[model samples]
Target: LNLVDLRLTGTIPPALGKLSQLRRLALHINALSGTLPPELSGLSQLEYINIYDNKISGTIPSELGALSQLKELGLDHNALSGSVPKELNKLNKLQLSACELGGT
Candidate 1:
């Protein structure tokens, strides 16, 4: 689903995780907040995820590495912490801010 630049607010609905065949998710340039749902690991077919430029926080879920099909991840300009899970080394593209580089 592509919800980019829609000015969306509030937290991402965790139920979205149930879309097991989802290939791409775009929720960028919004006001959405809160941590990314670890449940999203259920999206086994997910190839791209772009939740950039939002108010989301928390560490990048290690569970996301289970998205073996994930090739692109756009997570810059938010409030995330922690070192990116080594499992994400499989990604083809990754976006992150300087703060994220210095995070715990």
Candidate 2:
């Protein structure tokens, strides 16, 4: 399914990463928390992922690099900490702010 405009609440379900056919996942402006599920690395076809304006915490998942096709990623205004995953350097367009980005 070509679902757009996604608004997820609570912890991000690991099941979402199983949607191999998913191309664009937009989960902005929600109350999502907890560490980013490593399972998300399974979405091989994912091109866009926006998880801005949420309470999500923890370091950015390095597994996200598995999305070879991912173009844009938004993780602003969250409780996320730790250094930006070096893997994220491959992303062409990413928006992350107001979070610590240099630590163990």
Candidate 3:
């Protein structure tokens, strides 16, 4: 529940997926818009997720690969589109860095 860059707006409150021992969730550079709440893949002790520079759009939520202890996934900038959910490559401790979609 780090709530980084607290310019937060709205959306993303799917009850925080019931916080199943939530590990790290930094709402980066906020003004949070819509999409990206696949029940947060039920958390499952999420490792790190920084919703970078917000204005969130759609796609990229293939149930977040069910988290399986996600390493790092910061969706860079925003206005996300499609094509990125090959089940997140099964997360093998994913290191997606800054997932740039539209812009900053």
Candidate 4:
């Protein structure tokens, strides 16, 4: 599912985790806020997640590391804090530039 630059607002719905077959998720350049729901780990087939340049905050969920198929994760330009979860090293591409990661 792609909803890039749609001017979307509010938080990303946790119910979206039910989309078991979803492969890619792009919701970048919007007004989306709130923490990423760990429920998203249920997307076993997910490969990429691009939610960049938004108002999202909080730490990257360790649960996301469970996505063994995930290759790219674009979450830059947000208000995220804390160090990246070590469990995410398996990803081939992880983008978190411009995030408030406390020098980690």
Give TM-scores for every candidate, taking all chains together and pairing residue i with residue i: 0.93, 0.88, 0.29, 0.97
Cα miss at 15, model 4 (Å)? 0.4
Q: Write the number of the candidate with greater TM-score, choosing between 1 and 4.
A: 4
Better of 3 and 4 by lDDT: 4
- The CA lDDT at 19 in model 2 is 93
Please report the TM-score between candidate 2 and the true structure.
0.88
C-alpha lDDT of all candidate models, in order: 0.91, 0.83, 0.79, 0.95
34-84: candidate 1 lDDT, tens digit per residue = 999999999999999999999988888889999989999999999888788
- Model 3 vs. true fold: TM: 0.29
The predictions' CA RMSDs to the true structure, in order, are: 1.5, 2.5, 11.1, 0.9
* Residue 1 accuracy (lDDT) in model 4: 99
Q: What is the lDDT of residue 1 in candidate 3?
A: 87
Which candidate leads the pack in TM-score? 4
lDDT of 3 by residue, 1-104 (tens): 89778787989998898899989998988899998889988889988888878888877778888777887787877877766777677554443334444322
Superposed by TM-score, candidate 4 places the C-alpha of residue 73 at a distance from the truth, in angstroms, of 0.3
Worst lDDT window (10 residues) for model 2?
A: 1-10
Tens digit per residue, CA lDDT, model 2, 1-104: 32223555679889998999888887777778798899999999999898878889999999998799999988888888888887878888988887666664
Per-candidate clashes, comma-separated: 0, 0, 0, 0
Q: Find the candidate with the highest lDDT and give its number.
A: 4
Worst 10 residues of 3 by lDDT: 95-104
Q: Name the runs in model 2 displaced over 4 angstroms.
A: 1-8
The true-versus-predicted C-alpha distance at residue 86 of model 2, in Å, is: 1.2
